[model samples]
Target: MTRASSQSDPFRLRAWIKVLAVGQLSYASAVAAADLAVPHPIAEGSNYTDWSGGYIGLQGSASGAYGDYAFSRTTVGGRAVPSFMSGDGTGRRDQGTTATTIVGGAFGGYNWQTGPWVYGVEADLSASNLKRPLPSTITGFGYEDADAFNIIRAKTDVFGSLRARLGYSFERYLVYGAFGLSGTNARFIGNYPDIDTGALNVAKHEVSFIGFNIGAGVQYAITESLALGLDYRYLDFGNSRRFSLGSVPGDAGGPVGTQANFNAHQLFLRLMWFPGGLRVPPDPAEIAPHDPDDGNSDRYSLHGQTTLIAQGTPGFRSPYVGDNSLIPHQARQTTTATIFLGLKVTDTTELYYNPEFSQGFGLSGTHGVAGFVNGEAQKAGAPYPRLRSNRYYIKQTINLGGETEDVPDGPNQVATRRDVNRITLLAGKFALGDFFDGNIYAHDPRVDFFNWSLWGSSAWDFPANLPGFTQGVYAEYNQAKFAVRAAATQVPKEQNSDVLDPRVFERAGLNAEFEGRYVLPWLDQSGKLRLGVFSNVGNVANNREIVTLTQLGIFDDINTAAVVTSKPRRKTGGYVNLEQALTPDLGLFARASLNDGRTTSLSFTDIDQSFSGGLSLKGTAWDRPGDTVGLGAAMNGLSPSHRAAFAAGYYGLLVGDGQLRYGTERAVETYYAINLTKFVTLTFDYQFVNNPNYNRDRGPAHFFASRLHADF
Candidate 1:
């Protein structure tokens, strides 16, 4: 009985295993067969077909956003200080808890589609202006009843993206993924009035960043000739850091720091038409043999497209401006346009040129140039008159006192006053290959022509020791889940001299970055974890003038100044970043970085180190048509120089201390976009910043902006 039972059990187990294997095989076969079937409606003819072509379209949108700014004061020394400070002060401060702004712009792109799959590249650009306000009252150090009020302004005259997309179609709906490079030109403007002294001041700054973008979207085909799509993009523009100070008295001459990152969700509805219904050339099997009339060439076809877009510029910091200030806290806008283009080429290859021109106006404008330039000079206590000489050829001796005493007396004249005009032209070609693709070219990336507004400002007028030609090349490779980039630049030692001075100082540097992503198979379909690393290395030529300044007690009386003057210094450093995707529309990211000071070379004795890190979150809700939203926040620690500036601004505000320390700076920002209808969209955004170094009278500050966009 035991033998019989054991034999039966073995047979039963084998039978069950066979049954399960057969079932699995059947399921695999079913799936394979289903995949082979046509994914989209097809015209009766050949077994396969391709409608691989390029297209162009136009889009418009509207948006709005709000910003919050905060500041605080801290004491560094026991010395008595002034009560009112200029620019950003040392003490804690807050501006319009929330300020609203408006903006708008236009965009266009090209695409190619095939059976169940599509691949193509696209480019888009836009312009916008936004504003906000700020107000504050300060009292301390023999000074009281000091009040400062002003508006903060911002103008994003430019935003652009270059991306490549790959997608799979499920009948009328298409799911796609994209990766690319993006850039933007943005500016900040601030205006403030000192109540105690009844003095008005203004400041402005411009900055740019280059980074990578990753995104996903879905497209729905409404008809044979019309389609609509919604996409979410996370743009990591790296760090766009700028240094500036407000025009307040004690706050003057401190570092004004700014950093920016952008992420957005966009939904677009488009209409498309093709002259001939995806015509397929005659298949040999379907055509009469050698028939003279059986030509495969297709007649000319015409297509048109129009799209409505909704987008947001969420995280912005304008501590110097208030909610209602003339300056916009955050700006959002919508734009609309129609595109018309023709396509013609052979099957083996095609050559085409698409020339596009568009115009749209939204809430956008930087601080006026005059106000920003003068404000910077005023903060330094140099002012315009102190920088210019009334008598061009006459030498005059004048006694310097008060704030002017801080200004270096030697070589005070502008040695190189120049108005620069720069233009860039880029052209490249792609060769289609069976396996690998390659590209090569030699072109002038950027060219600048300058007019010497004043002889003193001319680079040629400066001593051979102070050459001034800054130029370089930058490039990177971007993939679906990873990216890498490197760049090198050179700062000439002399403007026109053929001889390169080894002692005068020259600069050469390189920067690199790497990022990767890993999808979590056990989690939801969209979950992923990412990691990245970035580094930079460079050398800076030494300058005699710098050594002299150090000897004159300008830079802490460091003896290493002579060594720095004799030879260029070398600098090397890097950063690390990690991120995780919680869902299809949500994610968290963190990063840390360190650098060896601003100059190219590192002197072990004067070595400077900086570290910074932060977290960010982004996601979208698909409840409404043509509407999408996103949010992010970050905090960073500055170096001693940055801390000093922060401390200076803090103390200068509460105690009227002139000393500046660069301290820690932190910021938080968010944004949202909603579509009211096919022709209109609304956008809102806000940003909050905390800085111990800002020199504005309002202390730590806040900023906000918003906008309404329309499409036609």
Candidate 2:
């Protein structure tokens, strides 16, 4: 988690201002005393000398921007219409203007100074929720009343940026220019009509964008160790367009049109602190030497931390089956406690272990263990694959899956499975450079966990399974303000019992995913906006084994035969997104994605093509003692068919569809957090999802949760 000053609430602003004021007054008083105590004149340094040489410093700044966005008619159906055409207009239009955003980021830099000139590169990244309102206007024939006028209002969410800087120092002041790529995720909200009928449509949109940033700033040193500065940046997100067609006829045309050009700008005031002097000698002997065993000696340190987490789900029991007996609703509560421990052995290596124990009123208690090792394989620069760090981990558990079964005239079925736990080995190299970095690694090669649930409960337990191995390799690269990542996963049939069951073995196959982003520079740091693209493809053997646990529960036996042979079903799709920083604490984002009918497997599938966008606001509202907070909200939409698929998956009704349909739900969530003290915080979160296709009678379900966190 990243911690920064808040930008949203007015109370927070006043509190921070007071703190700064007090600090300034204290500094002034100290300076006065120092002036009276010192009498010697300070020596002047050379005018041609530059104040640079791999210096490190901390900076704090205030940032803000404006984000403008409009929804296209084609993306969603056009504006809403009356049951009977009243003559307001044949075609409806759903259009909105852009909103404002605000956010701030901290940065540090290093420079090598030469006479009158300093050159090097500096990089910084920030996470912010900058949002803007997605204003939607409806213009139609019979939609005259404001209440009858169908309109959708929403905001955008989370966004970020990365940039590099170059500069020249003159005496006590330095002027610099920077250029780097950036990206963001935006949200769009609106209401349209059904393609067939002229009814109103309500939904939210989440989008992504890639763009670039450019800025200039000048810093003046108050002393050799402190500096104050100001900077300005411009950002341009080229043609971030979104298209959609609504469910209704009137809403289908112009209302579903497009968002054309997007852009923004930002300005900030910054202060920096450098603890040590500007320069350090290449050899330790060049300067006064300190005792090796002194308190300030540089040496490796070891530390550790542990956390306890508790979670529960009410109203529904998980459908998975495990080793434990059936868990009763309301009658039996499932509770678990876990311990996570870590050891920092060196600057580049650490080891960790996490163990968990769970107990239920009517079921057997169980225990689980997981361990991991993380370390740098070699020094900064080493040969290719040999230069990679390796990580090995293993997890073992004995538990039930899903919910318990209540059979009418048969013996109750309890989870009964035990096999060697899953083992995972990962190795990857970290890149080093001012402009680029890359990592490549291979993931676990075995089916690590079995997912199952019994009838009548909402608890999901993991069952130990030693199925055939499933492994994948992934690589990612970041260069010139752009990032790209690709991954491929493969599962062979001979590794498990399913492979021997010809019907299931054939279903094993390969899957891959690729994504990239490019930042636009027209917009400055404050006005961040970017463009992004992503693609995914998968090939599955049709003859793979198929098992319908739900059907077996209903009929007490396998009732269906395998239909497709594992010949590798091919699925592929792609998407484009645009994100903009609207204010110092808010952001606007939009995106359109389309997936072909091929990659619809367990983890790689989409119900249908989707276009979404929304706004989000994230910033600290208060910085005073015991008064810190952050807040955020978002909304989105899904086609009816897609919504149905999602509903089915949520209810555990579709066994073989995999995890694809779960991505189709239309939903929204709001979150807020408050700091009670420096180490303690409270958070509240709520989620609302509408899945009309599942459970038939329950239109949508609302979930609420709260958490208290303490950091030591």
Candidate 3:
């Protein structure tokens, strides 16, 4: 019998975002129309506002699931075939396991109220990382019966529910219970690897199920339009019908029937917004008495942004190409949508979580140019949209006695008053660049320049995973005119790998930076300077050693294996960044960086030395102050040993031409941005590169791109 495929398709993240966003806008529009047609006023002497409206919410959940798996004997010609046998031929027919994971999702509902009771109908969808892998129970099986020690792995990637809610209200709080019909998209895999013959076989079953779930929860109204809630749920997916594992074929087990049942317990926190509800104006006493002028006083903040970039190269000079060389003609586009959520836990402490969805790739799969073309593109680009909890962190501020400044709300930053002199501590998963190597005119690819070297110090080799983030702690001491910062973050298990090394103390990255603000004496305009240094310690290869080993025939090809299998080593680097406003509308910026090239490049590019500088001017002179233009140039080089490795045919992470005639890779980029609206902008960019991949044999190359960016 053929196995059943999952019912749900691999829907893109961008599509989901669009659907949710549109739903919200439509509800809000209806609410506006109702308000004009009818007035909703606070009932005289009433203590509580009515809870009757259309609402939407986002939630984070922690859940644990238990499952049991069973298998039946298989028959190809009406003869029973042994299945899931031990190494010694003892039959084992069942397996059991449990898994704990985190989940993120969105929900929507409409509530109806009569007196103190409320009822609602709701629906939700979520992304989950629920998985459990059973250990190999039948190892050491011979080549003849590779399926004997089949290992089972089960996981649920996505789930959703359509539910009804009943609740009772008491002043500002509500208690509720929910019952729902739910569905889960799950996969089960069987791995059969033969130690004797070194052959591997994998069988997979992708299945979806509709089940039942029950839950209870409580919610507190922070305002008439917003609420916070805690929810608990229990879901039961009944035993699945026996299905054949025909994807993996062998005489040991032709096609065994398999079945499983799953149950999960979830506890989640949700933040909800009522589009048809009115917000209660806060009492003046609730504001911080010391700084009433500070922007927003709300304890929580929400912001979002989306960016779409389309880049291409009509055609570039390419006499020959290697494994990692850039294709002469290619065009690609990338889309990213992010939600920034923050909560002020106390006067001096804050928590932040940024859930992001990304899809598409950069030109040439983000390779070819040493100073890559798109800074927004992740190294691990995906053809289909994928969601990641990119940044979740805690921040504590220690304010030293000093004058304070009013802060405006922005992405990941809550609006309030902050002391001019303060010490801040941040711990969690984030990017090192969040606190180091900052330049006013050249930082933030989403806001300014788009080239890798221009937006960042390319030679710093900051520790990060494929998405340019890592788990770490950062500290900053701020003064009126100067600041100092330091951080320690996790490095990847291997270069450009998504998995971080587990040995935190032994394999890590340490970084520090000092920044100063001053007025340019000659120009009478403000300027800033930032100097930073870093050291990364991990198991990595040496370029010189790899070259020598290849010469001695120990390795057939100069490949990534040398770096993948290595002893502990260190890579050190430093960078200097400067930005000065030459005039009211024009600013100049530059960066110089170098890294010790004894060890192979890890986490970043192959360039050991880099110098990048640029100029940015506003459109104020032409009366379109919101529009802007930028120009930048970068020069990248390799150390002597690194040059030799490439010349000897060693492939670097991003660029290698099989053979090398060394020259500095030079790139110049220019862009014009048109402000389409307060929250959206469209930009046209062009770049020229000489000696692509630092190979003199390769002629000059040109690239063109268009980008659409929006934020709120």
lDDT of 3 by residue, 1-712 (tens): 0121222222223222322332232223223322221224545544444678888888754221223333344342344544432111001112223233446688999989876788999999988866656443332234344343235677788879899999986555567899989988778787755454556667788878778989876665554566656566778887677665442334443443555566655555566778676323233234334343443455777777766665656454677777667765444556676889988887779899999876555665677788988888788765434689999999999999779987666688776678999999999999888788888788877767888989999998888988889998999999989999999989998777899998988999999999999997888999899999999997678888888888888887767547545777899989999989999899999999999988777887878999999999999999989888999999999999898889888777788888899999999999987775455566777888899889997758887766656665
| C-alpha-based local distance difference test score of model 3 | 0.72
What's the ranking of the predictions by lDDT, best on top?
Answer: 3, 1, 2
For residues 144-262, write the lDDT of model 2, one tens digit per residue. Answer: 34443334443444434566667775445567888877666665555654434646665565556788878766655544455545455666666565544233235224434455344
- What's model 3's TM-score? 0.63
- Against the true structure, candidate 2 reaches a TM-score of 0.32
The clash number for model 3 is 0
Candidate 2 at residue 695, lDDT? Answer: 23
Superpose all Cα atoms of candidate 2 onto the true structure and report the RMSD in Å to 1 decimal. Answer: 26.9
Lowest lDDT block of 10, candidate 3 = 85-94
Query: Which candidate should be chosen as best, given TM-score against the real structure?
Result: 3
Measured by lDDT, the strongest candidate is 3
Winner on TM-score between 2 and 3 is 3
Candidate 1 lDDT, tens digit per residue, 1-712?
0010112454334323322321222122222322212234355543333334444433322222212233223121222222221222111123222232222233445557665677878776644332333343333321234333443344455557789999875434456898999776656565545445656567887767677878765554433333344444555665555345354334422223333333333322222222232323234334433321222322112222222222112222333432111121222222222222222232212122222211121222211010110001111111001111101111112222222111111111211111122111111211001001100010000000000110011101111111112234434444445445444433234222223234322444344445454677776533222222222222333333443455467665322433344344444555444455555544444334455333322211111332222222222344553544444333433334423332322111011122322333444544454454343344444545454222233224343333233322
